[model samples]
Target: MRSCKDYSAKIPNVKPALCEAAQLQDSKARSVLGRPIWSRDVQAQGAPLRVLVLGGIHGDEMSSSSLVFHWIALAQTPPSDTPVPISWRFIPTLNPDGMFAKPARRVNARGVDLNRNFPTPNWARDARHYWEERTRRDPRRWPGTQPLSEPESRFLLEQIDNFKPNLIVSVHAPYGVLDFDGPSVPPSRLGRLYLDQVGIFPGSLGNYGGIHKGVPVVTIELPSASRTPQEAEMRQMWMDLLRWTTERLGSSASTTPASPDLPKSP
Candidate 1:
């Protein structure tokens, strides 16, 4: 039974983690909440494809939180080279206030669910006004007075604008569903691979992303807040995702022009 004030205290100050991930002397970027947010650059020489991995959108979704943290750990020593093929930008935890303060609180310091707070086209017309109709005893839905009202939501919006990733993955929990969304259809293999890994029904992040922007977004749902799956299950899902991404990248790379040194001779 955490009160709003109590929950506000739990939001982890992401500054420390963000700095560590970007390996920046100091984080120059800031989230909409005014917390420090950082970006690490892994540039590719040619038209490098960009991907954004956002986790912890829901405060209580521990598996998603763990996954993003794992990714940040990897980024600390990411392969260093120009034209690295893929540039990954991670927002390890979006709702720091919700995460640290109210591990139980799904919403922010203001009691707004960052996910539902997104600026959907019909936001105003949304009758439920999620906050007023919260489902949980210690629930997360409450869209604030308006959409994009909370800082965390705004922070994500900024990331979308600056990074413009070709793909976005938003992780959530308890349903074990892998939702694929975007303006265009997802690769058929993706749907099957996700089903094989997480073992839940498929879902769509692009339903909202599509209305706002045409980019594809996928939501990877985990089992639940309290029940963390076995490591083997988690590993299998990630491996599948990696395999899919790798195959896609390989196809893209093959279409590229011949190397500089050999091309001149021709």
Candidate 2:
């Protein structure tokens, strides 16, 4: 359970950029709303093992955003001669309009759930009904009128295309489990916490990237959205994630066969 204080030298003071609408607001709201924070490191050789980590796609999941910010702060310092050569891109909050809403909405300013707005093959056919049945037509889970309809979702897709991440870790909250999609590899301590693999939805990043595009997408569901992790828990989770990443990408261990029965997008 190491603290960021222990690696203070490695942490950089990176700032955030405001989204288009946020920039139009008065100074206070502009600073807080519709802002996206990112940290990038591309100092590796050849085509570096690109990794993208995102948080706060569902804006109500505030803890996920906090965890990502914490990780970004700690990862700012360049790694020293690490076995894994990687280029990291961290996005702390993608749906800032929802996250900064007075009561923190699950959907963005347009009332669309960014998570269900990716342009997956089944988006047109399955997103709306699946959301309706799953949450009893909850507004919180409403898919957009069409895939990639919202700016937030489109922005995420743009990053995926530009960065071409080898692995993506999207953090969510209050689910207390780890759900993974794509190729199979040795399970890690993080996966052990939530071994029950959840089914993928039509336009979920898991379905679009992992299932369809053959990329690994690991969704880390935090224990609670209402509360940030205690120091010890935060450190433990960070260590486990780092270990999993290094083992999966840096070593030959990642060559383990893909699961023949991996869930397919509906």
lDDT of each: 0.54, 0.66
lDDT of 1: 0.54
Model 1: runs farther than 4 Å from truth? 1-47, 74-84, 127-139, 184-205, 226-235, 246-266
lDDT score for residue 182 of model 1: 49
**lDDT tens digits, residues 134-249, model 1?**
34323545556676777767767766776667668787776766776544444443322344233111111354564457776767776665454555665556555545554554
Which residue ranges in model 2 land beyond 4 Å of their true spot? Answer: 1-47, 77-81, 251-266
Per-model TM values vs. the true structure: 0.67, 0.76
Error of 2 at 29 (Å): 17
Q: Please tell me which predicted candidate would have the highest TM-score against the true structure.
A: 2
Model 1 TM-score is 0.67
